[model samples]
Target: MKREHIETMISQEVERIISGTDLELVDVEYVREKNWYLRVFIDKEGGVDLEDCQAVSEKLSKVLDEKDPIQENYLLEVSSPGLDRILKKDKDFVRYAGRTVDIHFFQPYNGKKDLVADLVGKGEDGKLTVRVDGNEEILDMKTISQVRLHIDF
Candidate 1:
């Protein structure tokens, strides 16, 4: 099967297993280094524990075994998204509004490649308004190369 098809299958199976666990699926990637590695990141209101990871792992393993989507030898890793979780979808922007975020643009925006700002809100046109250094800037979602929650230490 194609890699994307396999990934979609794995994502669906993982979502089903963790539906009632209060955990949100952050992202899933199938990496092939020495062998296939399927990494699943999940998060919750507070956080996720090792036990949660283990439970999801076991359940997903059973599903994968039954489905056999991956023909090659592989290892499955289920874990928390951690402090710097990447924001991918529009829902992520809405869900994480009012939080500090670090965004990297494909091309420099206002002569900068990276920005650390407070997410204000999403505009009617679907642009993101963020306050960076006290200046509010409207960023086009299409230009965002990567966006992650910022952790203050």
Candidate 2:
């Protein structure tokens, strides 16, 4: 089956499995590096522990075994997105607003290709507004190569 279809099917199953739980489904990715991998990213307000990952993995494994969604053998991984997780959706932007983030760009913007700033919010034109050096700047989301949470150690 196509990877997208596989992801969709698994996503639906995950949603069903996590229905009554505090776990929130973040993303489902089916990819092949040296071997195929079915990775499920889950999250909640505080965080998820190893028990959470193991439980989801076991339950999803059972469903996948019964359905046989993917043709090839793959490793199934269930885990949290972590402290510096990438922000991929509009909801992510909204959720993480007021947090510090590292924004990457394909080319230079304001003479720099990357920036570390506070995420203000999503702008009217679908751009991301951020505060840099106390100045608010609106950036086109298209130019953003990546946006990840930034924490100072």
Best model number under TM-score: 2
What local lDDT score does residue 31 receive in model 1, on the 0 to 100 scale? 90
Candidate 1 local Cα displacement, residue 152, angstroms: 2.7
Model 2, span 29-144: residue lDDT tens? 99999999999999988999999999999999999889886889999999999999989878898999999999999999889998999999986688899999999999888898
Candidate 1 lDDT (Cα, 0 to 1): 0.87
Tens-place lDDT digits, model 1, residues 22-94: 8878889899999889999988888999998999889898888887778888889999887899887677889
RMSD of each: 1.9, 1.8
Give the poorly placed runs of model 1, Cα more than 4 Å off: 33-35
Clash totals for all candidate models: 0, 0
TM-score of each: 0.88, 0.89
Pairs of colliding residues, candidate 2: none
Tell me the spans in candidate 2 whose CA falls farther than 4 Å from its real position: none
Q: Where's the lowest-lDDT run of ten residues in candidate 1? A: 119-128
Candidate 1 TM-score, C-alpha based: 0.88
Q: Deviation in angstroms for 117 in model 1?
A: 1.1
Per-candidate local distance difference test:
0.87, 0.92
